[model samples]
Target: MKKVKQFGETVEGYNIPVLNEREIRASAGILYLLMFWSWILVIFKDSYLLLKYANMIFLAEFIIRIFISPRYSPFLVLGRLIVSNQTPEYVGAAQKKFAWAIGLVLSATIFLLLVVLNSDSFINFFVCHTCMIFLFFESSFGICFGCKFYSMFYKEKAHYCPGEICDIKAKQAIQKTSTLQRTVVIVFFAFVIMTVILFNDGFGAKPTSLWLIVKSAFSK
Candidate 1:
């Protein structure tokens, strides 16, 4: 029973239980895309059907992660399959459990408000976006936003972070960003603002169908 209920794998050379960070990121990416698509449908189509389903699924998955086992979580299993060919990057399971507890709370809140209660409000919007941001950072940058709070709540320091971020180490030469890079990023945003200002009207105009234009030209 203990074996079946274990939270993480006890791999050799690791003092504590650990999980595959690669699979975690892959799972985060999958959830992020799912929630983003449902959000788009909500915004454009005024449909809550997909969003509600997403919330239910999200809630169930997190419940499994926290209560049952990460190994049995459907999305995690899928993520493992997707990244099976790649090398596994092991990270401490304790911080991940804490992080996923936050996820469970957020998902449950969303399910309650949007699904069970059948309501909408700023709270729902805020929480949904918060989840998206968490998932986005985890998947895209290998950063765990929720894991950042582990140290605050617990006495012990987090171990084996995705990028060894828990350790205090100087940045490598290759990892350092130069002043020119910062300047270029700032200039790029400035250029983007100018572009929007100049092209607002043109960009807002509805596009014409190419087939319609071709047909009209041939007819003429």
Candidate 2:
């Protein structure tokens, strides 16, 4: 059982030094979704406190993860609890550490620009959007953009990536799908789009401005 340690796993011949890919990705998924909504609040209400303090807390967690240990990270603890029943999907911890290092740097930058300097400017916007992209890819797609730097900066390749994306390409067997199945999937979404676009008038009345924009776009 390897003493049920929270950081890293020994798989095959590789010695990982951090959380498995699944738990980390799941944690990132939760974190990014919350951050995204917080950003939306920033957009509408001009709320910087939520975004600023959240970035600082995010950087602190990554510092614990990268320097102290993943076991001590509160976010990773929540991540583990979230995916307690899922099977482990192991990957190289060194690469993930590299990724989190980038995360720490980005978070620190956001903290400095938004929190300390009070710079409500486009540079802050650009950095925030970039972080969103990184988080979105990792959380939504299980793709680590910063981990891609592992091979370029180091000698070894990251293994057991979420989709085996690091492996060399192999020919895949083709399977034919019926046109009826495709039609069903397409029709389902088409129905949903029409329902929202055609029937929904003002989108809950309070957020009428957003709905007005959508209505105007569709009208044009």
Candidate 3:
């Protein structure tokens, strides 16, 4: 975290280190891709066990973030961009606010459509490929669709504004893992878990494993 003086107040003690953007993007991008693959396994591969267990992990992580460490929201990254040293030339107070609105709406629309349409393919496409492609391009070439969209919508308003939150020296970025690395690891792990569930001799005995087994076992 970095400290900076703000308008009419001595703001201090609020600073977040510059993490490796490459890694952070990669990590998030991979997780998003994994979500799609997990969905595929659930629908086409009949890998219920894998999906169930993976969801548990997700739930646990969500609990930790939402309940335990509420301040670790990745969206803060955008907020940081507003005040950090790495503030983009085009971003400013108004642009950041605009970006927040647009980004939220875009994301909500995506989620809503996916749910209402039961969009297996579209969800898979986004989780498995879209996010990765976008993040990869951003990390490697500094291309960002979110950034571009914000620019287009707020170009005139933010043309001369430098959206630096404060005159603070913040860290660079946070990097997770690379796309290739995440894909290989996540897919392999999912496959293994599915295989175990499918092959387990008594998988049907459990409440959630092979539904067929539970159905027949109960019939008798």
Candidate 4:
């Protein structure tokens, strides 16, 4: 799969990697959606009293990854695993560092959003609704709302280095997965969103701030 460079220089094939800014954002978006579901359980029959604890687990993971995960260690991880260890791609490594930094910030924001605004109504109205709108706009117009805002922070941001792969590979993986994996992925996200919506509604107006199902002893 050797190919000529833009400058007409000969180069060997690059192992196509799946990650880039868009895919990274999309994954963070999915994780935030999952956080929405975790909060939903807290708002429901109080069955998920552990929702708060779940945040603790994630916080611990982040701390460990930052301090202990070799995959995240400066000279040991990420690109070294993907691209050859001998010539670890600096571009890929830099992109991963940026992505991880953004993930940490996003994760902290989500944790605060859940802890401070435990109300299901707030999560549905602000987090879920806003993210859904952003995602739809991105998918429809090929515009990255976050990238635009992120660019405002730095002068050369617009000309920033995207990960190793070109636009073609990024879009392909972002758009498609194997059929069965797609089905499962679609169903999983749909279920999370619907569960958040339904449970939010059911718990929003309850006097005890909870919902319960009455079951006959013999039914089970």
Candidate 5:
């Protein structure tokens, strides 16, 4: 019973329970793609079918992760297989649990609003996007945005963050951003805005079918 109910694994050389950061990130990526696709369907097709199903899946997955062992979660199990070749990067489970608790609440709210209540509102818009942002950071940047709040809620500092972000240390040379790099990024954005302003009409023009164009050219 204890094994089935356990939250994290007790690995060798670790005093506290830990989980594979790689698998967690992989799982986040999977969820993010699912949610993003549902959002696109909602926007382009004006359909809530996919989003409804997505909310149900998201809520159920989080429930399993929090209540049962994460080892049993389907998404995490898939994630484990996807990243099986990579070396495991273990992170403290305590902070992750706190962060995922927030996820559970968000997923539950979305499920209730869209699936159960059969309603739509700005609250749904805001919460859905917020969940995506969290998933995006976790999957893309290895940043756990929700874990940032763990220290605020608890007295003890979070340990073993994804990138050792919890420990205060000097930035490595490679991690430092140069002034030139920052200026280059700003200049690139400026160039992009200028191009958009100059070519808005051309860019917005509808594209013709290549086959139709070819047939017309041959006939002419």
Candidate 6:
């Protein structure tokens, strides 16, 4: 689909592809959610075939979105439908395209190394972990690390990046955390850490995950 240019937003006298920020993030959230679940299954159940297919799907989606059209990407189409009624948050699309290119590279690598080569290697693990990290940040917190990378190498930062991460520093309470909030967060984590350390079970053994635990409960 051809991007509809915004009435006035432009950088360096070039009309950028303006898009609904909410839909983009919503779509990303959906995709990441799928990837996270599939990866967890692979890690726990050793579902190599399932993981291979998932990687292939991600690779294809990225290729279509980047090379052909976003409308042709099934995940993005579903995402747009999901957020069709959402209020539009217009953002610069050039940086998003750049970010998608980065995603393309990651997905393509996973497809070639893990799915195609069928290697159960450390490098494949690293690639999958890195992909999850990137996706998790974006889906859960609306922080696009790829967009941050784009801003770092490029002169113009993403205008209206998600979560206003690229926004100029301004004096505001929201920008600064209160001492009480900081102390509460730190104390909470410290307490949890101490509780785990003090009453730990299976200190060296791989703990059974909630997924496995639930399955055992039902199967019995």
| Per-residue accuracy of model 3 over 1-220 as CA lDDT, tens digit each | 2222111112233232222333333444444455557667867986645544444444443343333331243433333444365522332233333433443443444444444443545553454344445545544554445544665754453332222323345655454567888999999999999988887875655466578878989999
Predicted structure 3: lDDT: 0.45
User: Which residue pairs does candidate 6 place in steric collision?
Assistant: none
How does candidate 1 score on lDDT? Answer: 0.96
Minimum summed lDDT over a 10-residue window in model 2 is located at 1-10
- Number of the top lDDT candidate: 1
lDDT of 6 by residue, 1-220 (tens): 2353222234454356565666667777877777778878887997877678778888888788777766567886787788898876666676777878888898888888887777778877888778778777766777777878887888976776776777876767767888999999999999999988986875767877999899999999
Q: Write the per-residue lDDT of candidate 5 for residues 1-220, one digit (tens) a residue.
A: 9989988899999888999999999999999999999999999999999999999999999999999879999999999999999999999999999999999999999888888899999999999999999999999999998889999999998878899999999999999999999999999999999999999998999988999999999999
Q: Using Cα atoms with residue i matched to residue i, what is each candidate's TM-score against the true structure?
A: 0.94, 0.74, 0.34, 0.35, 0.94, 0.80
Better of 2 and 6 by lDDT: 2
When superposed on Cα atoms, how far off is each prediction in RMSD? Answer: 3.0, 7.4, 14.4, 12.7, 2.8, 7.2
Candidate 5: residue 180 Cα off by (Å): 0.6
Please list the residue runs of candidate 5 whose C-alpha ends up more than 4 Å from where it truly belongs after superposition: 208-220
Measured with C-alpha atoms, the lDDT of residue 48 in candidate 6 is: 78
The residue-by-residue lDDT of candidate 2 on 1-220, one tens digit each, is: 3344445655665555535667787788878887898898888997877787678888899889877778778988888888889987777777788888888988888888888888888888888888889888997888899889878998877866667788888647454567888999999999999888976875655554877889999998
> What tens digits encode model 1's per-residue C-alpha lDDT throughout 1-220?
9987999999999999999999999999999999999999999999989999999999999999999999999999999999999999999999999999999999999989989999999999999999999999999999998889999999999999999999999999999999999999999999999999999998999989999989999998
Per-model C-alpha lDDT, please? 0.96, 0.79, 0.45, 0.45, 0.94, 0.75
Model 4 quality (TM-score): 0.35
Please write out the lDDT profile of model 4 over residues 1-220, one tens digit for every residue.
Answer: 2221111112244333222334333433444555557658756865444555555544554454444442333323232433342432222222343334453554465567665665444543454345445545433443445544544555643323343222334455766678899899999999999998889876676454222333443356
The superposed Cα distance between candidate 4 and the true structure at residue 57, in angstroms, equals: 4.2
**Ranking of all candidate structures by their TM-score, best first:** 1, 5, 6, 2, 4, 3
